[model samples]
Target chain A: MAPMSDSSAATTLLPPGSLPLDELIACPQCDALFHARMPGRGQRTSCARCHTVLIAPRTNAYLRVIALALTIVILMVAAMFFPFLAVNVQGFTNKASILDTALAFLDGGFMATLAVLVAAFIVLIPLLRAALVIYVLAPLAAGRRPLPGARHMFRLSEDLRPWSMAEIFVIGCAVALVKVSDLARVEFGVAFWMFAALVVVIVFQDGIMCRWTIWKALDDTRNR
Target chain B: MQVDDLESTGRHAEPVTARGAGLVACTRCTRVWPMGETRCARCGSELHSRDWRSLQRVWAWMIVGIVCYIPANIFPMLKTQVLFTHTESTIIEGAIELAQHGSYGIAFVILFASVAIPVGKFVAIGFLAWSVRRPERLHPHHRHRLYEVVEFIGRWSMIDVFVVAILAALVQLNFAASITPGPAAITFALSVIFTMLAAQSFDPRMIWDHDGRGPDNHLTSETP
Candidate 1:
């Protein structure tokens, strides 16, 4: 997913005195080991071995990240409770929200498990991720020190990244909708747009937030 | 392992890391300072980047994903009702239905996203996990590339779920026609979530861990 990084130029050179192995960060992609150095606020450094972005802290990234996370939290709630789609076919009409669709499977035993899983994938994990991001980044955004276990919280958020499937759900829905449009009277609800917007915001948040920058901020604040 | 080993002694048997090079590079930022540097001078980040237990997590998640995939295929992905008639279709059945109706492209998209990719990932991750230790003549870099490619495509398999969400939202024809997600949707989503987790858990760096100590590490061999 991290296809961005420019390492065209030569890496810095200066192999100095003995340092503990813990001080070195090896390139996960290419195993290129270079000394760690922070770039200026506007500048970024990429791994010389793989050219993966190492550190590029944008000025307002914390604030922007918090904002996007909050938005997703709100979107997930609305997506769950609100009516998702309604269709009318020759004097007959049926409508269901995301929650209702999930609950519809509850009539069966094992299906109930599926229902719970769907609800979790479509709603819970994303909500949890968004909430975690806000909790970890909000203090930094407000110029206050990160709360206790902020490092753990941020790592949790990052680890949860791939498991949060809202955007994928949205895109899958779009493709499915294309196929369904030919069969019925399709009507996208407000919740659908909410989800659609959530995808863009989440992607933007991921792009803007630098893990190194955030970790550095947390560590600095804690050490202070 | 030393660049000097190759130049000064004509011996490049060991990896650059194995040479006891007192240098560590920041994977995030290619800043090279002394080995004792605790943080990246440019990015203010902790220099440690090795994921010590990557394989264990990858295998765990892969098993979980495979387990969840069981119900995903057995249950209906969606239920379609048309003028007092109801029809439920599992993902494969739905795709076949679309193919029957000449929506071959959409059907293929669904099939590939829902079936092929998830199963492919299961195999791919297993392969990568196995091949990392067993020194294959296949270019090690190509294995690394495979891991990257899998990581990049992880979210794409969710297209089937996305399609369901979209159709569920859009295809509502009151009493006449409607499409609702079935039990399989959630299981499918879970499988995807687990697969993604498995993929993320895989350490791409392990692709470079060939025991062969082949010189091919520097020169990428043709993909076998």
Candidate 2:
């Protein structure tokens, strides 16, 4: 199962010294160069191209600590309340927030609840990651170097990023909404809207806006 | 020969460099090539150039898709009807119905995969794009880390599409209860597709653009 075809081999070229910071981690199996984190002094990370474990650079320690804290908070919130959405059809209406859904699954004695639990991975774990990033960056931003924990957290977040499933939840909702329309009467709820908003805000605040800048700021502070 | 010179000129005229020139060493034969070559002179492995424009375009589309997504979820993505009576259903509504019917597994899966994941992706991607646009050069590693996050999570955004497809295919009772696609379904699907495109279009190499010198020479020296 080759990822690329044989004849479509025309390649593009780049100039030397044009992208100094671009790191290449090779997949041991395929010998392909893919972008990856720098190996830590003693730690090993897997290659994105082949999933081969390799030694890479260390990440900041405080970031992990902060991420852990934030993760805990988000998890607590997700556990306490329903995430979003409720459905009504044929004189019967059922509702569950994110938390309610979890409990429902647990009580229902269905192992499939694991899928739902996994979905929260993005929502809850990223919160921890964000906290870890803050922890690492805040002191670094203030001109202090992070300890080893920051590096571990950085790696953990990187690994976890792909596994988070919040966006997928939204997709299922859209699909189900379409299907359920012919069968029942469905209505939107406040929690649904709030969860939607929360997803947006969380992405805005964490993914694009917050973590990188703080790290960059910390990097600059470290250089200074 | 004339065309080659012209192509080179055109390449040089462009603001970005081709990705091929960035590979310092061949993964297959360990042969190093100048950043300006299209193939590993030794093994003929195709090379890549650095082009952030695709990423930028993807970001723009993702923003638009996310905007559409919000409305798609909020404004009753679908209208449901049983026997000529109609009701509107938001994302959450559908999930609730599944839960109440003792299908807690399906219900939670719907909530997380369809509703939550898509929104999270939008936020995460949006944040990553904005951070890239910033002039700061610190934390190049972390920026790369963020790019990995966005890229890894990109596919999970499709969970919604999968759910929709699955339910639409499987859940057909006809009259006693039937499922139908809605206006928002198209929009939601587009949102997922666009965001996925955005993720694909985003060349993570752009994160290293700030360090525009070339890969670290120490990469080879440090490897065992």
Candidate 3:
């Protein structure tokens, strides 16, 4: 594929009677086709039929996404090690962090797999995705070409999006807290608030990330 | 890529798709490639105009997910020992216990995420797979929307599993009181993973490529 020009218009020369195939885009959700047009910065192009956001090029979106990703990585690490909650009942008190809970399942049997999965889904996957995002976006944000294997790392990050369960884990923790509130005196720890903030940052990062804009930027710079 | 210029170019009455134009779009990056290209030039991922095996893979994964869901419901999800009073509760029982404690909102969230969403995904994905074979059953727009919802909500089902992990981790006080994950946690996690795979295996493009006047029309007629 030829490098797209800096202008928000198709640059590659079209062959005779070939339908300007280079300028066409198919909606990922409904397969409806549209002539690819870059909306003005801060505007969005959505599929007509399904309303799926097609292209949204925000000013400095890359920098913001990278910043949020870095925050997620920091918060996730802290949440894993720092105490998450403490339960006190009948003069007995015990505190546990996320890592402590996940490892509780490690009894060298079927439960060991659960331990690994809990660690992966809530902590490992989210952290890896954040790191991959930072790795892929940092150079791009600084007006340099993406690092080597940028596309592969970006693809892996997107693939792990659904599997990253840190936000869901926070909601789960809230439910668990309420479930045990009557049984014990539960107090939130430093890590609990950090996790809450981490969830908000993650949501904002995902919202601002326009895949089409990122892919176009990557392709344009790589070809140069 | 100029929006104003594209608006002046006029629009087609019927929706056109990449497959109908003898092209393919990368599922990950949405970059278009000619039908003859086996891999995306930009992303280096395989390109297929239509994955003919999509439905088959969906069915296989969905069946396994359903089988695992059965065991997930029957087995206990959490085991609690409170000063020699042992209690084992399945997923529904846990939710009910929460509701009985007047934590109605949290209970609803748990029940909705753990039960309603998973069952809804199975039904929605099954309908999408069945409808693709006989496309006239439902409108393509609605089917595509259903697919989007299924893909979006599949991850939230992990909330219950995370709650179990957090509870098992936090509620430990030696012989006084403790909570541990039961046999159901792993089966439930597997079910969610399998169903997610089933959802991902489905190609939303198939919703628009109806029978008879389908994707092969342009290729067979060669009328360009």
Candidate 4:
């Protein structure tokens, strides 16, 4: 709390072992560093310089995040096979699912990679992240020890966070569907709603879960 | 001032550091430690000052993104089948179609999300990467802000791909009317994925590596 302002652009010296250096935290955004002190449940700690939320612990966050991750898995699986859309126009009607849409690109060799990449980002990455989240969180939520390789699983999940594009896919579809409405008789399928629900649940999961809290929980439980 | 005198004065108005006093902050938990300390005692994370391969990864991913982006804009994004008559539209054509149909709102959104954002991201990421290598081009703070902007807007670039997914999913009326994702759908998604990866591969901490030679640093700050 020593005048933690962005104007002080230079990082101050940490006196050698005079104060425990391990107790400090650096603002990830502005590089202005601060002392590290975990916020209690229902409290939030933000970077003093950039205001990025450093930690915000919530009660029962683990349980809620786990629940949402499970929902994403179910919704994603259902969204794959279930008809995502059925447009009927002038006596011709066709239904398509997410898998069908992704596979449609697999016409030739070069396109095959495209199809796989699309499918991986929109479907596989999300599903994988959700599964990893569950694997990492469920044991901690149950007041049990961290699962085997929980650290690696957690790291992988964090790394893949940006790669999971399921929510983006659904929002993009909504905008696109609005544009296509005039051209065809478009109808939302079960998978569309499922994807929609999955998005909401995922947002909720992200909101509830605290990265610092979970990591602390995992680390504490590991050596016990 | 002596270290003890400064502490006793309690006006401790110096910059914080991971480099000062032989200290390093944990990237995950933000805990500061002695420079030689390999592990963050609190979070059990390997502590490092800056990722050594950040620029390398950023350049590699940007190359892939640039490569994929060529095909993304060149190919048709969506194919519309109306009454057995097929029509293919690249992203620009689709936006033009939307504008012609008087859905200007959707059209602008499409253009903004598809073209403007992606191009902006490429430029921003390139600028950031360049700034890291050549810090004299722009203010380090401004470069850091640009990096944040790139990271924040990364997901929104997928809007075009999403629209494609939605239309492909919802507009299925057999021969009368149906939309299939064109080859560009996959390419565009890949471009977005690569750019995102590029942004991620960049370590923002490098932005502050200005060595005090940064132009106009003194002009911005008013010493209190």
By TM-score, the best candidate is: 3
Residue A140, model 2, lDDT: 62
CAPRI band of model 2? incorrect
DockQ score, prediction 4 = 0.38
| lDDT (Cα, tens digit) per residue for candidate 3, span B1-224 | 45444433313234456666667778777777778888887777788778868889999999999999998999999999988899999999999988898999998998998899999999999999876766656766668778988998898999988888888888888988889889899899999999999999998877766322223433334322
* CA lDDT for candidate 3: 0.80
Give the per-residue lDDT digits (tens) of candidate 2, residues B1-224: 43345334433343222234344443332234456666653234445444445656876888877876876676554444456666666667867866776777767766765667776777666666665555253354455565666665556655644454333332333444433334455466567657776776665554444242222233223323
lDDT of 4: 0.71
Top-DockQ structure, candidate number: 3
Clashing pairs in 3: A9-B1, A10-B1
Query: What is the i-RMS of every prediction?
Result: 6.4, 13.0, 4.4, 5.8
Candidate 1 TM-score to native: 0.76
Candidate 2 residues lying further than 4 Å off, grouped into runs, are: A1-224, B1-32, B39-48, B74-84, B96-108, B133-142, B208-224
lDDT of 3 at B25: 77
Q: For candidate 3, give the docking quality class from DockQ.
A: acceptable
Clashes of 2: 68
Q: Which digits, one per residue and each the tens of the lDDT, describe model 4 over residues A125-183?
A: 88998999999998888888887888878877877777777777777776766786776
Model 4 error, position A157 (Å): 0.7
Is candidate 1 or 3 superior in DockQ?
A: 3
- Of 2 and 4, which scores higher on TM-score? 4
- RMSD, candidate 4, Å: 6.5
Worst 10 residues of 3 chain B by lDDT: B211-220
Once model 2 is optimally superposed onto the true structure by TM-score, how far is the C-alpha of residue A66 displaced, in angstroms? 45
Model 1 chain B: worst 10 consecutive residues (lDDT sum): B2-11
